[model samples]
Target: MNVSNATIEDVLNRLTNQTKLYFQRDNNTISVTATSPSTAQASPGQNKTVSGLITDATGEPIIGANIVEKGTTNGTVTDVDGNFTLQVSGNAVLQVSYIGYLAQEINTTDRTTIDITLAEDTQALDEVIVVGYGTARRSDLTGSISSVQGADLTSRSTQMLSTALQGQVAGVQVTRNSGGPGAQGTIRIRGVTTLSNNDPLVIVDGVPSSLNDVIAADVETMTVLKDAASAAIYGSRAAAGVILITTKRAKDRQFSFDYNYEYGIDRPTTRPTNGDVIDWMNVQNEVKWNDGASDPYSQYSQETIGSWLTNHAVDPYHYPNTDWMNLLLKKSTSHEQHMLSVTGGTEKLRTKSTFNYQKGDGYYESKSYERIAGRVNNDYLVNDWLRTNIDLDFSKSNAISPSQINPISHAYLASPYYPVQWEDGRYADTKDGENPLAALRLGGTNRQNYYKFGGKAQIDLTPLEGLTLTAIYAPRFAFTKGKKFTRAVPLYYENGSMTYMAAHRTTNLEETRND
Candidate 1:
């Protein structure tokens, strides 16, 4: 059209398809434009190629942005340049998305190219959190409540349920009575609230139970209701706070099994060392002289004292100055725990069962604990309007220790000059000496066995929308049997001979309790 020999009027006259082209004249040049291609007029049944670029607010390309046709899986991912091409219906709507960004939809009504920008999502502030007997959004909670997940319990080597929370939560104090095997600590939230009893209310799977019977392996979540407003639902029983425990439930799956085991050694943190025979005699002499009396130890000549000091180590049975602390206590004790669980579910029913066994030896001989526990939880959707749940748990524990006085206290109080055994293999019991090792080996014995069982059955009927009629019945039973046997022997003098007019007595006690 710009030929030097052809005039502008002549070129316009020779154009046969003027309606399909448009011309515009500028100060220095002429421009021509043609109609769009046939792909722009494609129908729903026809497929067309669409391409686009995606970016964030900072104008930087977003890698791996998903470009998909609405309601379908036909999609493509963006390249390093934030460009993507996909084959889709001409009238299709695209769903563009990326992680941590809000998704968007765009319509491709007569276009072949699209450009999208996504904004970051900020919906985590409204996340739902678990509360007492229900769940609420974080924004709706006004009282104090602390929650601990199952993962936190799995990493610790705690055998008792209450020991797992030691030092893990604020405002919660856990104190163990002693370093004895299977010792359970006391958990007090926000300090003591009552003068008589400061123990918090422990609820396991909606059933009131002792914390010792609840195995740590079966717990799914532990929530503490700390404030009065949050614990008001429990009434006067929750004056010291409330501990809600929820056990693991069966998931939607076929059959699954899990096993866990732990084994470790236990030892006392400190051992007391007392003075030997020579030191004991010298102290006894000093005490007598200080009391305005002559030395009572003068009855034993200098030669006897020198012999005791020389032969105490070589002939421990004859002239023994034994270290009762080390002789009566072991270097270290051992403990073992095992847990097994099975879970299964179907379209209308789900069930879970677990079994746990634990055994621990105390630092002293003849002191130990053994326990076995099992639990079963099941739920069934009988029909569209009827549902039911069943839960059953049983535990049996046996604890054995000295009935009268603990061995550690006896060892510290007993005189060090007393030998553990005489030369004739008889327990030594002099006029002024009490062999603590004899009390631990042939003294009083106490054994206690406790059995607990709890069962719950619940029925729920949904008669209308947002309304449910429920009924629950839970029964708990416990039996404790304790046996005590004390051996009373005649008092002996310097030799292994009973005193004149002395008699031996034996007593046996059996106790049974039910609740």
Candidate 2:
């Protein structure tokens, strides 16, 4: 056991000689194999040198094909001529593998020369990816682009298409700007490229649009152009990056209808912790004493603090350790989404329609978001050389929240000693005029409403064998309306005394814009 000065080989020899074990050394490590009296004298299997030519199903040579011995680390790759020579034990299985091809296992039991033919993996290589202005097979594209299928986007419960795009691609960063309901994340491709706006140009079905305007369920494919060369078609608008989105269209002679519903809960994972009344008063007194002050910094005296600690359990309404976070926020907010899609068409005429509705509540009370969107796409084959397509999309959304004060920030600043409400159902006064609960319940309302309508028509004419002429017309209209109403709130002390009015005035403001 104490072989500090012994070499590895010497230790291994000692271990092998003392027990019925055999050691095999490989790359600075020794592996032990047990040996018994019945098979201890058996001879090792003989290794045979096998040479083979690997080819695809088309009878073409496939260079760099991997030839690995089954259940072992012995492997070799084919040379330029698709010829590989590997030494393997008798009765060994030769596993042949290549990219974009199905692997095959050949049993080289009694043969010295073997030939393998690997079939093309059509499912892996035949995926059609949408690129700029057109589509290409996955194996044919050589650009800096990443594709996400619609099935993958709708696999999870997400309110925004941008939210579902997070972690779906490489070199892309999706950061959320806020934690409010139905919030969309800001995406940055290959890091920040400009100071003003780094948002990628979003193109939906050949028309410039917003990511939030497209429903996740309606997406057929989402492709991101990471490099400048791949996004060169958009000119300066694609200086940051580009995101091409293609919505689903009608299939040939197929009629299908689908309805999907999702429900999710949102809760804050972390919250700021503030000291209780006793701890606050103690810290205040300590700060004043350290500052060489004659009296405590806080208005409450030591006797009052002691009385609060003693009677807070029985009389919580008067001397309470109020948790502003819990008072301002609910335990958990919920969101729900519903989608309905109808697709029916023939070989000449095709049509697809989708409708989506979503409602979500923010972590804070009295904060909510709602949206409804619909899309319709139609394709017409007028003749052998003429084809027409039409697309229409519309959406409306409303976001409501408190306008007077930020409830979250105010919650962190509000003192814990103050009670949310007095025993007589009156709002309690805080050192600061802002009470998060009061601001949420009685403060002004900030409502933002947005409406969007987009229409596109395209005609394709083929006059020659390989010549085609195309014309497209797209028009988009958007309307935004904002309304805010501020109301005054009065606070009362425990003894029914009046404090300063919180807002002190009433104001109504409305704004509308068309684009």
Candidate 3:
């Protein structure tokens, strides 16, 4: 160390510490080697802090903002104060967004709180679709199945499934036979099948079934499996595709109920007219060859026939009890339907049950239908990983007396002079008139009874998040029994001889089961 003349290095050494070094080489200038406090500021590294007063494009403070990091699991929704703090990493991009505003991204390199204004994302995600056994984005589906969800059915005003599908599905047609309750609905998809009977197979929960299987309000969805690939799995009876019905499931903590109603008028078809041309030629032609030779109608004198045409107009035995056609017909018929359902579940058990009633009156004599149907579905969530389910469907339907007619030939065989009369004061049974009212009364009264009871149960073990193991059992029974009685009605032999009359009874039953 030079002490003479106060050399630069000697003076600098006294002032600078070991940590700070200051030196002069040729006694010309001094150099300093040390960290500048301004350049050595502390950093959070991967962690980021964003601080900015959110505001609208007009700079007014936005009350609440939601900020999320682009690709990681970090996200923070803004508070009511419209301010937010986001902690993110170095390589991370901070996403600032809100319900009404568009999203904005800023790199967290060296900034603290970045005040940002966001624009709304007008193009939101499309509707979420519920597909078979799973939910899909819709665009990714390559199959021919169509899913009809609960929300879609809830918006309709019909009581039955048949009414709901009308005018709703392309290539699917639903025809309601009449306006009365218990009226049957016919459905045809695409067109009639040719190779075999083309009727579609219906599956409820996994078992074959139909609209008769449950109330509309108790149903969750109806899926149409249209193509071979989706339907082939059901086999022999599935040529016409498949209708899969999913019944409402029990909720874990709430009891729910619903009701639906529809009221309308029954419009009918017009009746026949043209009352004049009875003439004489047509009746004569229809006479049986053996009897035609005898001119059976001419057997009645001209005066008698003239009297029948004016005053005894509607009779076969000098009585006005016959119009043949009118006796065999009916006027307008009407109906009503009501349905009730309740569904709910607890942590350990759940249930869904429904009751439905329908009544229909036909425009024809004694033609009517009445149905009473009930259903019960129960599920027990046995434990965290096990569950059991049960489904029951029962119904009774009956068709009332309606008119019977052979409109084609009734106009030809009856003689205007011969009157319609019965020994019992009821319209008599004549070869021509046939006494339609008598046939309904004494010819044979028919009573038919139909009953069906069906049920299914399954146990499920869900060991994984989305996988389930299932076992099922099913049993069903149906019966139709008819009783008829016809007292001594005449049976004529070919030789014009009368033979003995007869009475009979018919009955049948069907029962099925699966395990």
> What TM-score do all the candidates reach, one by one?
0.70, 0.78, 0.57
| Global Cα RMSD, each model | 14.1, 11.9, 19.4
Q: Candidate 2: which stretches are off by over 4 Å?
A: 1-99, 103-123, 270-274, 289-307, 500-504, 507-515
Task: Please give the range of 10 consecutive residues that has the lowest summed lDDT in model 2.
Answer: 35-44
Candidate 3, residues 302-354, lDDT tens digits: the string is: 55545655654454344343454444444444567777878787878888888
Q: What C-alpha lDDT values do all the predictions have? A: 0.78, 0.84, 0.60
Q: The CA-based lDDT of model 3 is what?
A: 0.60
Across residues 1-515, which tens digit of lDDT does each residue of candidate 2 receive? 66888878888888888885877676888767796423433223877788989988788899999999999999999999899999888778999999888988998875668988899899867888888858888889787889899999998677889989999999999999787887899999999998878999999988888998899999998999888875568888888889999999998898999998889987779766767778877887888778887786455687888788678889888678887777776778899999999999998999999999999988787689999999999999999899999999999999998877777786677778778888778887876565667767876788889999999999999999767798989999988888887777777876788765456344456565554
Tens digits of per-residue lDDT, candidate 1, 1-515, equal 34468866556434525555544445657656564344336888999899988999998999999888998989999999999999999799999999888999999977778888998775744656566666676567788877777678766776688888887777889999876767889999999888877888888877778877788778888888888975567888888988888888887676999898889977667666678777777777777767776656654556777788678668776686767778777889899999899999997999999999999988887798899999999999899889999999999999889755577876666677666656656666733435556656666678888899999898989999878788889999888988877666434554556632111244446565654
- The alpha-carbon lDDT assigned to residue 172 of candidate 3 equals 76
Point out where model 3 deviates above 4 Å: 1-137, 147-167, 174-186, 215-217, 256-267, 274-309, 312-325, 382-384, 401-424, 430-433, 487-515
lDDT of 2 at 370: 97
lDDT, candidate 1, equals 0.78
Of the pair 2 and 3, which is ahead by TM-score? 2
Measured with C-alpha atoms, the lDDT of residue 328 in candidate 1 is 76
